[model samples]
Structures are given as C-alpha cells and as structure tokens.
Target: MSYQLQDLLYLMQRLRSPEGGCPWDRAQNFASIVPHTLEEVYEVVDAIEREDWGHLKGELGDLFFQVIFYAQLAQEEGRFDFHDILDALVVKLLRRHPHVFPNAELYQSLEAAPPVSMEEVGQLWEAIKHTERAEEAPHQPTRHLADIPTSLPGLTRARKLQKRAAQVGFDWPDPSGVLDKIEEEIQELRAAIASGRQAEIQDEMGDLLFAQVNLCRHLKVDPEQALRSTNRKFERRFDFIEQQVQSAGGDWTRFSLQALDAWWRAAKEQEKKHE
Candidate 1:
C-alpha cells in the first residue's frame, strides 16, 4: 500500500478505537454499516450515470471508506482485517485471469492456451468462479442458482440467474421466444388477478418480472439501468405536469385525469422538442 493509504488505515484504526474516538464511529457494527455501504454504492452509480466526474470522485471515496469500516469492525471482532481483504482480492484476480496471469499456479497448465476473445475471457471468469464456489463447499453440490447472492437487487439477481441457466442451454432460443414467454406470463398474471388469491397473484407477478428480466438480457439491455432511465424520465415529465398545473392555478387533485393526461402529453412533446 502507498503511504497515503497506510495513513488512511491508521486514521480508521484511531477513529474506531475505544479511547478518544468519535462515539458514532466507535459504536457501528457490521449490520449497522450495511445501509450506509449500500447508499454509498448507489450514490457512486448515480454520479457515474449523471457523468459528474467531480461528484464521482467523492462518491468513490465514500464507497472505499465503507470497505475500510467493514475491515475495522472485522478486526475488532478477531476476524480478517483490511490487508487480508486486499490479499484475497489479489489472489482472486490472479486466479481468474489466467490469460493475463499465466505465471500463477492456477494457470500454469494453461500457459500454452490460444488467444481468447472477450467472450471467451468472460466464460473463463465464470468457470473460475464456479471452481472457487465448489472449493468453498466441497461436501455439498455446487448449484449456480445458489451461487448468486440474495443481497443483489431483484433485477440484477434475475439477470444473473437467467444467464447462469442459459450457460447450460436452458435459455430461450432468441429474443422473440423471450417476448412470447413474457406475453404468456402476462396472461398468467391476469388469470391470477381474476382468481383473487393474493398468494397466487404474488407468485404470478414475480414470474412476470423474471420473464421481463429475461427479455432484457436477451435484448442486451441491463434491466436495472433501463428502469433507472425510465424513472428519471418519469420524474422529469411529472415535474413538468406540476409546473403546468400551478400555472393553471390548480393543485394536482383539482386537475381531472383528462387534464393531467393532456399535460403529460405536452410534457412529452416538450421533451422531444428539446431532444
């Protein structure tokens, strides 16, 4: 580590110390820090999406500090510390990227392998991950579905599950097939709604979302990114509607659905014009 990073580590240790440390910093535990860590990750993603490089730098620092916080807590608990985290990452990186790190023991036999495309590199990465998971639980059978973290966002987890199944030739042939399945899922959801059984409806709704995520994967679109873009567009258009309603001397509820629809259309038109 650089001197600056070592200095930061020392600061973290001091802040987490029982004596003369900030009370809030000294009190946090792993579970308590999780929400802040997740928030920092989302903030970093937001900065990147907005193309705000200056804000991104700060967000990245915040995200890195979350790692440091976790490491500090682990050290207090007699678990691994920050250096162990870095060492494990180094090991994993060298083990996974055989094409780049052929001198490593994991890739010594593959040193003569042919040049690989990016797609092949991705396959190699997945294979290495699978091997690592198997090594982690040699007594139990490895299941790709079980390898995906439940903590991931719903859409991301859905995509990963679909991709893992697709690797074993379980996916639809193409986007058209996925679209057909999506329509079928919609019909099932409608049926569940008509049945008026809440549990059935929930199950069908989940299936619909999973099918939609499959369609997104087939179309080469990230469902999370696509939804976020749509969310931003909705917020922008709704803000325009609010402005128009105020100009007309009315509140949102005072405007009829037809009036709101007209405003929405106008907002969309204005957006198109700006584009």
Candidate 2:
C-alpha cells in the first residue's frame, strides 16, 4: 500500500511523543536540527549534480522531512502546523507567479493571459517581492542587505549581496572591472602575508575570496556551483594519483614531486579524451 504525507506526519509525531517517543527525536530542538537540515539540503544538491535520479527521490523526501520536522516542532509549541506551512507556501507562490495566476487566483484559467518573457517575469517577481517586503514592515526602513540571512554559505551569500547591491547601480560595470578588483585584492593579500600579521592576512583573504565571488557573478556564473565542479575534478584527479601510488607498491616515498605532477597532467589528458 502507498503511504501519504499524513503517514509521514504521524510517524514524526510518534517519534516526538512524550509518552513513548524516541529519545533523540524528543531531545531535538529548532537549533539542534539546523545542522541536519543543512546536511540534507546539500545531499539533495549533490544528488542532482551527480544526476543520480534513482536516489533523487530519497534525497527529496529527506529534505521534505526537514520541513515536516520544523512544522511539527512549531505545532507542538502552538505556533503553527504543517497545513499552515503549505497554505502560506501555496499562497506566496500564487502571488509571485502573476503571469500564471493573472488574478492571483490559484484556480484561474491561464488561457486569456498573455505570455510573459523570462526577463519580464524576473522583473515582476522582484517588484512583487519588494512590495511584499514593504507591506511586511511598513514602519521599518528598507534595508536590502538586511533580509539576506547570514547563515547562508559564504559564497552564496556574497553573490546574493552583490546582486542586491547591483539592483541599485552599485556594482562593477563589467567582468573586466571585477577581474581588476580581484587582481587588486590578490596584491593586498600578498602584502598582508609579507607583513606576517595573522589578523591582516585573514582579513585580506576574505576580501580576496569576496572579490573572486564578485568576478564569478559578473561573469554570470554561480561561484558555489563552479567551486563544487572544481572540487569534483580535484577528487577525480587525486583518485587517479592514489591509483598510481597503489600500483607502485603503495610507497609514497618512491615518487618525487615531478612524478606526481606527471600523473596529474596525465589525468587531465585522460579527462580531455573522455570529453
């Protein structure tokens, strides 16, 4: 028999029940579950990047369970429940996609509404979000950077902050300008290293990374995704190196730096041939 979402919610409730609940589940709180939620999110992203369709469903279910867990906790506190989460999500999505739901009505037919270009859709989405933000805090001053969560991964958050600033004409005019900024940051980083001040080195390092993220943004590339791809490539090349070492009697002492360099080049050539 096929189980439904209600079944999953029931299971969560059982796990968190005071009477006979799993101790681990009962012990967890919003703060404690955050790490697990982030891990599950990365797992979903990894599965998609690997094109692991067979396991994607399981990863998605794990991510969805995170939401259910949060909802259960909120429900227990009498704040809100899973149904409320769904209602808010549906309402927000319908509000955002005005092209699809012309009257902001979920059940409205789309036959009469004219199609919108992708660029126009993006503009409309941002405009609607801006209006929503204003309505959410009518008295508070609008701060574009304030809404971005500091908990976001550094590279992702940097890109978002840059994009937000760009909307107000506060960004590099082109990728070339970003490249120059990155070069300038690199020079400052080198100077900091020469000075041998740990604090200055760390500060310059962060600036260098932030500048690189800006370069990625100006080039229309996602810095996080680009780094992930490079990480995978590094793994593949290192695996090749390990295989070579194992073949050579598993003796790292026998191979020189030159030999390892040769193996790395060979790995690159092998990848090129596959491509």
Cα RMSD to the true fold for all candidates = 2.9, 1.2
lDDT of 2 by residue, 3-107 (tens): 998999999999999999999999999999999999999999999999999999999999999999999999999999999999999999999997888677887
* Clash count for each candidate, listed in order shown: 0, 0
Q: Which candidate is the best by lDDT?
A: 2
What lDDT score belongs to each candidate, Candidate 1 first? 0.91, 0.93
Cα lDDT of model 1 by residue, 102-212, tens digit: 776543544457779999999999998988889999999898788788999999999999999999899999899988998999999999999999999999999999999
Stretches of candidate 2 exceeding 4 Å from the true structure? none
The stretch of ten residues in a row with the least summed lDDT in candidate 2 is: 106-115
Return the TM-score for each candidate structure. Answer: 0.93, 0.96
| Regions of model 1 farther than 4 Å from truth | 1-3, 105-114
lDDT of candidate 2 at residue 51, scale 0 to 100: 100
